[model samples]
Every structure is written in C-alpha cells, then in structure tokens.
Target: MIDLVCNVSNAVKAVDPKAKVYINIGGAVNLLYNDRLLGCIDGVLREELRSHPGPSGPEPQDPWETPAVLDTLAYSHSHGKTVLVGSRDRLKGARSLCVRAWSHGFIPVPQPAWTLGCSTPPRQFGAVAPQWLKATSKSIIRRPYTSIQYLSLFDIL
Candidate 1:
C-alpha cells in the first residue's frame, strides 16, 4: 500500500511539483496511522460517513464515532494531513453537517454543491454554518479552514 501511494504521488509530483495527492482508503481509516503511507499522501478522503442505518431501518450499531477512528484522526493531524469527510446523503441537513464537523474536527465536503454542477460556496449555500469554524489542526482552530487544491492526475497523466 505504501509503495502504491508513493509511486502515484511521485508520478503526480513529477509532472507538477505542486500537485496534491489525496487517498480514499474507504473504511480502512486505520491505515492513516502508518507513517510511511502518511508521508506520501497530501490528504485523505473519508467516504460515506453514513448517519442513517440504511434503506431498510436503523442500524443496531453505529461505528463512526468509535474511539479508534477518533484516534486515527488525531494522528493524521499530527502528521499534517488534511482529513476531508464526504457523504452522498442529501437527506442530511446543513446544521447536522456543521455539528458533526465541529464535533469531529474535519472539513465536510459539500457534496450538494459539487453534485449540482454549481460553484456555490459552502457558507452561502448553508453547507457550513458561519459559527462553525473549521480547524485544520487540533491544537489551533481560531483561524478559518483553507481548502487545498492541486492539479488532477487527468491533467498530466
């Protein structure tokens, strides 16, 4: 896994030294603790932080807030890796998203904004509340969160 991450990261960097490489390990978030893997990637995309159980009914257990995940998040921050949370469930309200982000210390990706093919800012569109400021670092959160962008692999591959 480390080799793959390093190869892809190096490939992207070779074309554009400023490129940012973010990996989506899906539910394998524990891999964030690996120093070698963390060293090669710029950030991580945590997909489907599903709040609802499913289409059928409520789940018997919810594992999103488990201590292990929380610990991994802290470790990622200490390594200077951005954690981006993504969810496709539009049923979730903006306030709920903000509360989750505030509680977990992650930047919630505005799925609606991107899904609708528009460029509405998260604050203006209500994806993020003005009062809920994002803190990239666990120790320092007074400053606003800044989005990092890099050239896509498609641009140079």
Candidate 2:
C-alpha cells in the first residue's frame, strides 16, 4: 500500500509538478510515521477526529491532544505536508472542533451535512473555504501508470 501510494504520487508529479495528492488513511498514525509515504503526498485527510472505536468498545482518544497524533501532525508539517482534520457534528460542535483544529495548526474540515456539499455550510458556520474548495482547476490528476484521470472534483461532497 505504501509503495502504491508513493508510486502513484511520483507518477502524478511526473506530469503535473504542481498538482497535489491528498490521501485519507483513516487516521493511522503508524502510517503517518512512514517517511517515504509522507514524502509522496501533499496532505493527509483524517475523516473524523472523534471516530468511534467500535461497538461495545472503549471510546477513542482525543485525537487533537493525543501525543502520537500531535507528533504525527508535527512530523507531517515539518515535511510541508498538510493534515486536514475533519469532524461530523452539529453546527456548534463543528465550529468548536474547527477552532481546536486551527489552534493546533491542522486544517479543519467541518461536515454539517455532506449532502449540502462544501459551499453552503462554510458560509453558515463562518468558516473560510479552503483554496482547493474555492476554485476549479483544469489540471487533471491521473493514476500512476494508468489512464485513469482524477479531476479536481471539489464541492461535490
């Protein structure tokens, strides 16, 4: 998996040097510790900071304050990698988490209602939309060694 991600990233950069590759590895801190994988991608997207451990299991650790998570964020930032932390909750809860994320230097992605897409709730929550979300790009990102083109598909929720 690491090799695949690295190869894909290298292949993408071979064509469009400025294009970014962001991946969501489901908040795996161990994977974040992988320097090779870290070097390839532009950013990491953590779906939910407060993810459920599992049914009938212990609650999850606070990702924002967890030592390993903080270390991972620091490590990624040191390599010029963006770490986007997202949370799914009510408007107020989203705002709170967004603040927490920003305070820790991690970009916050608030999902009030995924069905509404990216634009509407940002305005409602008074949060600034990220650059990638604010505009469209003509540059198409393709998979490594394949013809599969992944367009800049933002605001699609």
Residue-wise C-alpha lDDT for candidate 2, range 14-116, written one tens digit per residue: 8878777887766566787888888888888765566444566435667554666667777887788877766655454676766787677777666544533
Taking all chains together, each candidate's TM-score versus the true structure is 0.65, 0.68
Pick the TM-score winner.
Answer: 2
Q: Which parts of model 2 have CA positions greater than 4 angstroms off?
A: 53-65, 112-133, 139-157
Total clashing pairs for each candidate:
0, 0
Candidate 2 overall lDDT versus native: 0.63
User: How far does residue 56 in candidate 2 sit from its true spot (Å)?
Assistant: 10
TM-score, candidate 1, is: 0.65
Candidate 1's C-alpha runs over 4 A off are 50-61, 64-66, 102-104, 112-121, 124-157
